[model samples]
Target: MPLLAGAATVVAVVGAVLALADVDSPLRGPFTLFFLLAAPSVAIAAALRGLDPFGRLLASVAGAITVDMLVAQGMLAVHRWSVRGGIAAVTALSSVLLLLVVVRRLRGRTASRRTS
Candidate 1:
């Protein structure tokens, strides 16, 4: 998971830098999607492997959503919103959902153990 997170971070940084440098490139769209989407998913996945799962999940979700919203609003303000923005939002939300599932599973296991 840590390896995945590191890879995702590197990808996100590269994408973000590329997008910042050339906003009109065809590749920018996909890279932006990757940066905006995969980074948080990686963070959440890594967090699930540690303690304080709920806190980490919430922090990841909040940070991801904040970043996504800021980028979306910035693009919208500049009248540059596009399908890529939608893709980013969906991807981030999906990642958050995945994290929620992991958290729920962990909670269930703990509860079952306590009851047993």
Candidate 2:
């Protein structure tokens, strides 16, 4: 599990770096797409711990797509659309969601320990 997570993190970072740097490598597109999909999916899936695996996967993927679309639409609406901006916004949003899940889990553990 840890290895899989490490691999995903590496892929995501590489994708973001490639996009931000304006690199023209063949890997830029596919890796960026994977980063866009995987980041939010993982963050949302982390939050939804009670659901069955298949259901969680489905929901998280759907949520990830929704997040991506919403980010694009928002940027377009503001007339500030750019690839770097979009990637940065998505990364920040995903990080926030992941942080929330981590905080919630830690709070739950501490509260349970107090009760015990």
Candidate 3:
């Protein structure tokens, strides 16, 4: 599990760097696509810890696609559509979602400790 996560992290970082840097590598497109899909999916899955694994996976994947579409739509609506902008927006949104989940879990833990 840890190895999988570490590898995923490496892939995501590489993707973001390649995309943001406008690198001319064959790996960039596929890696960036993976990052775009994986980032929000993982964030959503973290928030939905109560669900069974399969259900969570399904829901999170759908949610990630929805997020990507929304970002694209928003950028198009504003007439500011660009690959880098879309990627950054998605990244920012995903980070916020993950951060909120972390904060919620920390609060829950603190409350449980206080009660005990």
TM-score of each: 0.39, 0.95, 0.97
Tell me how far the alpha carbon of residue 28 in candidate 2 is from the true structure, in angstroms, after superposition: 0.3
Error of 1 at 43 (Å): 9.3
Cα deviation at 10, candidate 1, in Å, is 1.9
Clashes of 1: 0
Candidate 3 lDDT over residue span 2-116, tens digit each: 9999999999989988999999999999999999999999999999999999999999999999999999999999999999998999999999999999999999999999999
Q: Scored by CA lDDT, what does every candidate get?
A: 0.69, 0.96, 0.97
lDDT: worst 10-residue window of model 2: 4-13
Task: Give me the runs in candidate 1 sitting further than 4 Å from their true place.
Answer: 23-27, 37-51, 71-116
- Pick the winner on lDDT between candidates 1 and 2: 2
Specify the highest-TM-score model's number.
Answer: 3
Model 1 / residue 107 / CA error / Å? 32
1-116, model 1: which lDDT tens digit per residue?
99986877777767776665656777777777677756665555565556486777777767667767776787788998976555555565656767787788899899999999
